[model samples]
Target: MGSRVMPQGAQDISDPFIERHLVIDTSKVNRNAERGGFTNREQNGVTDQVSSPRRSEIVNRSLSAVKSFGNDDIDLEGGDVEKDRDKTIRGSRIVKVRNQAVLSGLAYCISSCSMILINKFVLSSYNFNAGISLMLYQNLVSVIIVSILSLSGVISTEPLTWRLIRVWLPVNFIFVGMLITSMFSLKYINVAMVTVLKNVTNVITALGEMYLFKKHHENRVWAALFLMIVSAISGGITDLSFHAVGYSWQIINCFLTASYSLTLRRVMDTAKQVTKSGNLNEFSMVLLNNTLSLPLGVLLIFVFNEVDYLSTTPLLRMPMFWLVITASGFLGLAISFTSMWFLHETGATTYSLVGSLNKIPLSVAGILLFNVPTSLQNFASILFGLLAGVFFAKAKMREKSQS
Candidate 1:
């Protein structure tokens, strides 16, 4: 057939008759090319060979069409896409949790250091009883400030109810115990020694959890607990001196701290039920606890006959006193939040280990800042105690893994 040409704009060249004829003509040409200089028998022998390339060319053209439309690309099924998204989300969550844990640890350390500095500086310039009074003043001021902030919407407001008050009452009592004992320890002991001894709380808490709450722990936890006890005792014996008042207060501080942690955990677990509220924010708890302490502290000041010191000395008027009190209060709050957050993020054992590491820097800072004299024996004791804490913590983690 001669080349068939379409008229100008002839219905956009839609012609099945022309297409059929063109295909027939192309087939004839391919047959002629295959039989070039070959007899019929030879052409028959090469028929399969000639058909193979033609089939391949058709396949290639089809593939090219698919490529042009991007249809040949692999299409991930719905399930596969969802699984990939889930994996990404899980990874992000894990990273976020770990970051929170680290931030909490650092905050606790910084707060601890700040509190130590402020307390030491204040005590060096004032009487013990007077310093206690100043602490009370600081709490009072904090409560007032926090209350104002809450009302102004800078801080969140917590619902106050009888049930909430009942639950918070005991916690505040424990808080008071911790504060008074810790402050008393500062009077006779260096900040470094006090911090080392503070590790004893971990041991005490473990026992309290086991005995009181019936919380089962792994063998490693017990081992860690044992190490902590031994370390604390050894550290104490090595660092022992005739500072009876300070030593006694530190022992009380340890007990109080342990009590605080145990009680706080219980309170946190049952806060919603006990308060008849959905959940209580930690800031609200802080506010309530500190507010309750104000009256108790005032009453204690009178009982201890420290009201005279407050009246005679212009401690409140001194900028140094205000500075120390403000700094210490903020540090106290920071430490409180960080420690709680760490416990929540990494569990008790890891939190305790991090706390143990904190003692070294605190001890060094104490000696340097307060001129705390230490014998070689005392230094050795501290080192041993720290090592024991590490071993115990590791053992506890191992036990947890096994269980």
Candidate 2:
């Protein structure tokens, strides 16, 4: 009677059915290895064998379930097996994500530092004092590259609308100001010294975060900020050739630079709403940023009286000049692409930290490549400054951890 008749719903709880849906959590496998998954086997000098009672109990239950299901003429797709496989796939995906993030950060650092050095060479060595003209040309190059990619369907971006452009205008203004002042500052400042001085941007950004967002910094953060200030002052005074105009422009750049990063965060949400694709991708931001800068760049070119120089300059006719500037333009685009890639993969904090970490090598390269005059004291100050940057990055990361 027991074999021939069954209660209602008894089939639902049968071994076959249970085996198909039963999922055993293997998450404890690693934990059990520490204290539970070992057995003594001194006869063969195998002190640790995988014959522990806990492990045997789990294996026996799983095998018994499979055998009972088989006896019942049922095949189990194996819920526990599926789960374990899924867990393995998820673990690999997590590793892949981290690897990509590290690669992105590295690429961003290389492009950013190299772009600065190349631009400095073009402006200083090539005798191109027309910083705005260079910026205009570089931005135009970025626009063209992005356009070609979009047209070829290798990439996609949103169409321009006045409503969208208007929402982005404020951020664009700050961006233009940052770029122009960067050019102005780089013109007269040595690359190493420029990097050291630019540390002030962090201070300005922190102040903006505190005042605007009402976020407070820890004491360690404040101390790091103080070190940055001292380094900046000492590095400034020890400079072999200090340009007042350059320093002033860089100071302005600090504020604008900080403002760009902070404002970009606030505007990103709104910028996404108006895009033709209704998605704000890196290419779209690149397109919008470089495109908007063009008109303003033209105005600045006129305001700075570079048009006359552009018309008469023999460098404009030189193929080598074109080649170098074109390369710089490509590098400029690379910087934008990589910067966005890194920011996207790693978030703002890691992006900022990697940037700060990159300044040391960039500074050393600048001094060596450009043959900038430096004394022991000045070099020490730059070192101190770079270390201060490292400290600040750590402080920010720590504060983030605690919060």
Q: Pick the lDDT winner.
A: 2
The true-versus-predicted C-alpha distance at residue 154 of model 2, in Å, is 2.2
- Model 1 lDDT tens row, 1-403: 0011111111111111110000111111111111113122111121334357778778656655554465323222323554565567667777877797788778766765666667766776465356457557667666666677789997684767777777778877777766777677777777656655665766776678789999777766666557656666776777744377887887887777667666666675555676545755545666666777788888888887888877777776889767767766666655545655555565555654565566567677777776777888877766666666566556655655565
- Cα distance off (Å), candidate 1, residue 113: 1.9
Q: Which stretches of candidate 2 lie over 4 Å from their true place?
A: 1-106, 276-278, 340-350
Show pairs that collide, candidate 2.
Answer: none
Candidate 1 lDDT score relative to the true structure: 0.59
Q: Estimate each model's TM-score.
A: 0.68, 0.74
Each prediction's Cα RMSD? 25.9, 17.5
lDDT tens digits by residue: candidate 2, 39-136: 32221222345578998777667766766565443234444654565567667777877887888878866766767888888878887888989888
Worst 10 residues of 2 by lDDT: 1-10
